[model samples]
Target: MISSKEIKRKPDQDASKHYDSVIDKVLQKLDTVCKEVIDRTNQNNQQENEEARFGQQVKQKPMNEERKEKEENALLLQLAEKDKGRLHLFIKLVDYMTVETLVSINQTSMSMLLEEMKKERKNGLFNTAVNFDVQIFTPDEKEISEHLKCLLDDMIVVMRNTARVISHQSMIGYIKNTKLGELLSEQKENKDCIADVQGIITDSIEYQNIKNEIFEKVTSDFQAAEVYVNTNYMRCKPIYEFLNTWNQGDFENKEHTLDIIKSHVMELKKWLADINFYIKDIAKGILNVDGKKIKNKLQPQVVTKLENFKDYLYKLMQKKANQTLTTLQTYTSNLSKNPQNLKEYAEFIEAIQEAEQNIKGLETAKIEVEAMHSLLKSKFDLNPLKNSDIVMMDDIQAEYLRLTLKIKEAEELCKERKQEMMKKHEAEFIKFITNIQNTTSSVNKGKLILEETQPADALQQLNEIKTRSLDRFKELDKNYQHYAKLMGLSVTTNKDLQELEATYNDRRMLWTHSDKFNKLYEDLQKNIFTTLNVEEIEKEMKSYEIGILKLRQNINNLSKEGRDKVLDQHANRVGNVSQFMPVIQALGNKDLRPRHWKKIFEDLGSAWQPGKTFTLQELIADGVMNKKDKIEEISAKASGEASIEAQIEDIKSKWSQLSFIVNHYREAKDKFIIGSLDDIIAALDDHQLKVQTKLGTRFVAEIRPSC
Candidate 1:
């Protein structure tokens, strides 16, 4: 009873199972083979034990053999001489290695030398391999000889010792033959005596073995500490996913919305899956291989509804038929009876007949209304009936049924006519619906591919549309939310619409004001900059007023802290002005010398010292400059120095030291602020004017002693 989806194997399980079975079978075979190998290993182990024991017996005689070798040193010397004499080729090659010959010269000589070296290296390797092949020797390093040569020589010593041991053992065994029975009896006695000490010795040996085994075990544990791993595969993914899912956020005051959202998400997934082929077609269309996307998307659709305008028209017609039948019955019966109410009955019959004839027009109106309704509904949902069973006619059929109360005598005719109309309506509706459904379903599922339509551009358009729709939808949703809280279907929407219109008008007015304010702000900036001889600056210095205004504005706009910085900038600019002022001042005083200038400069430099002062008239006398000539003379003189700009700086520096107190007093006298050069001049005017009334001397006097 499991669905196919549920019955399907989980991912990788089949491959995993197959791999496991194959590995298990291979490992089982390997285990059997390993068992056979262990058996062979045990058999080999027994053979190795026997050989080792036999070797141990031979090892027991090595102590005795060493003593014999010490006693036979003289004979060994003789054998060594014979062995050395056999080394004729080795000695001859060593003799050839003189200093210059060993160091190869040209390519030819190097080749010959390499050949000789190879021969020596080969001999060394060969001697070591052959002589040391059967000897028990430790590889001890010797600095004087090469490694192979030393190994071979050491092995020769070991081999000679082995041979001597064998010879000594053979000699000892032969000598024992001379006193065989007594020696054998003594040997048996010694063996019995050694057997008596074996138990105590074995106890000591067993204790040492236990201690060694413990040491080995501890070291084995140390080595085993290098690597480790753990295993846990069950329930990890499921638990992690559950934890992650539950840890997410929840909706506020609308928990059921989550279920609805989940449903939407599932539907979205279905839509995406179903759209895969459509997306592929889109991609192909983008490649411009085909171009029929929009046409396919916009094809007109058909809708069927028994509960529509056409049905209402059919019912109206049926009602008209009933009325007609009733009117005929009344007219015929009245004509036969010759009654007084015949005129009234005949007039009623005429009215009913007229109404019945108008049914055709009513049906036509229903058809028109139904056509428009069908267009909107069918385009939205082609098979809406497939998903709905609840029904109610909103058109002609409903109207026709409603009118049945006016004519009880013709109910059967009305009912019969109603059935006929419905059958016809249904058949026609179905035919139209089926044709549209087939067309829509068979429309090749065209992609909305654009030939040259930029996807990004189209996407942007789509995004704009989506954004607009979402904005409206969000507004609608927000309204609904507020509505749900306030009314919950209590208030009609028109009231809210009125409120919205008022708010929109207010916002519109505010936006208009904002735009006007922006325009005025820009005009304000331009107007401010244009004031204060902006044109005069251009005429005089070719420096547009823009730069000057900008500079001044920037200074004014600076933070208070930044503005309160040192007047060094003013001093510097004064110096620059001073450079041009002096030459002009000296124009009328051609007899002026550098010495006079020095004296005036000194007086100005010292005027503002703690207790010092120099009168304005005195300074004028020192410079030999009068009021009429002051501006021109100062400017021309100041502009004359080698570094006019630096000289101007010197001039301003001197002016500041001498005039700072005077300038301060003048500012208090006239309420002048010290922002510009003109302010200083204005302060000076006020000071002079004030002092002139207070018994100040008008005549010039030398400001400096030397002057």
Candidate 2:
């Protein structure tokens, strides 16, 4: 039922509404996406800012930690290196004891074999007798058995002592050879490593395992050795006694007596040889011999051989003692004759320690040898040697005492020499310091004078100070070098010298510039006016200008206040001289009249006074000359003279007109009679008179009659 136009409009309107709805939905989607993007960007920016603030600290923390860890590790490694010898010994002992190829015996037997294998191994009497085949037949089996059992017990005791010593040594060696061992030993000295070492010990399974293995092996071997020796010692005594008494029946035979003599001789040789070995060990700081026990076990032939050996040892000790004393004397002589620095003194001290140790060793050897001498005498009633006196410990001790006294004297002398040298050095240093102080004081005084006094006086005083300071500094420098050389040092660039030189150079530069500035100032003062010699003032001014340029070049070297003061003074001088420039230039001008001279004097104001012979020079030097205001007044007056003359004429003409009017009025009144009083009465009624001039017409006077 609708029209066609209405239908067409309805479809178009619907399409338009749909298009607007679609556009609005698309715009909402875009807004949401944009908002999300903006929020993400803001979060990213915040995160980047935080990173920028703390990034350096976060990055450097781990690096610093790593560096510290490396330093600690390096310190521990160095300490471990010092224990290398102990480590090597522990490793060797473990390898030898635990070798798989040595399966013939337990570790205890191996340890005993190791001890016997030493070239300097010692044996008991029973073993010595068996090895040497000494035959002694006695009918008493009990006596032989007892002797054999005692020897076997002695052997067991030696073996047991040996095992105990080796076990202790191995334990100490194993502990000190590891890093943990080093840390424990050096904990007091290196406290910084204590925590690290503790951590390593607590945390490191490998270190714990190593420590356990060492302890277990050493303990096991020692216990096994103790058990083996205890069990076998009694069983071995019977076998030992049987072997020892196999040749017992031959005791009365002549050949048997000869063999016994030979056996005693061989035992004496072995005993003496052992004594010789003990002497060598004592020399190397090892003292393990017991002299009294050996004395109780001696035989007759052995005592005789020992007596002879004693004489030889006495001579040998005496010779060695004399040699040691001679060496000490040589050291003392060297110490006395040479000048020793710290290093040489340290060397001498070390030599003294070594010599003292040697004397101690000889004293010990002497004790052992003297004990043997006493034993021989007591046991066998042996007579003293006919030709040789025994070298007692006292003789060596006396020489040691003399050597110490000489060293003390030498040390005192060295100390005295050092004191004397230090005194001389102190005197020189005081002299040098005093000179520096005096120079500084004088320079400061010069600076004050330059600031407060006149240029002439300041320059004179500064020159004198400069000369004296230069000479003193030269002497001080020479002596400073000498003092440094005496102290065994080089002082080519000493701090005191550098500072003094800088002060001197600064003061000297100031003096030079001050002299130049004063000269220029004086020239300006003196050449302010022309002289009788017409060109003199001009020539001086030219020279002053050149000096001004040169002074300006180095003006910055002065302090700010000083530079300003100099510039101000120069400007004042130039201004004072310029004030007279016009006067000087006009001196040759013949056109100058009295009025021109008056104008110039007026411009000078209080600077030039009457009745004073005025020269441009005198005017410039006048202290009270401060009339800058009159300069423009004088210039204007000088430039406009014709105008002044014209104004004067105009004033004179006005005065003439006033005078004529007065005279004319008086004449006219006198000529009138009483009858012509009408004009006079009119004139009297008008009491004011007017005069005309070039200015204007105005009332000049009032008229009055005497009546």
Span of 10 residues, lowest total lDDT, candidate 1: 226-235
Q: Evaluate all candidate structures by whole-model CA lDDT and list the values in order.
A: 0.34, 0.44
Clash number for each model: 31, 1
lDDT of 2 by residue, 479-520 (tens): 556545544555665455555566555545444545565664
Best by TM-score: 2
Candidate 1 per-residue lDDT over residues 1-707, each given as its tens digit: 22223323223345335534643454345345434444554555565576568865655557678568545654555554444333332222322332112122222332342343334221121111001122211121121123223322232222222211111222232233334334544755665312122222223444345434433432332222111100111112222232235322242233332234334334433333332322211111001111123213211110111223234333433444444444444433332332123233333334444545655655554454344345324433323432211122342355443343333333333333444444443454345344433432221111212223333443444344335543454365444434233211233343333433333333223223223333433432344321323233223222222323333344323324433121223224334423433432343243333544444455444332232333333444555343334444443443432233343345456557644323444637766444446656775676556434422322112311221
Best by lDDT: 2
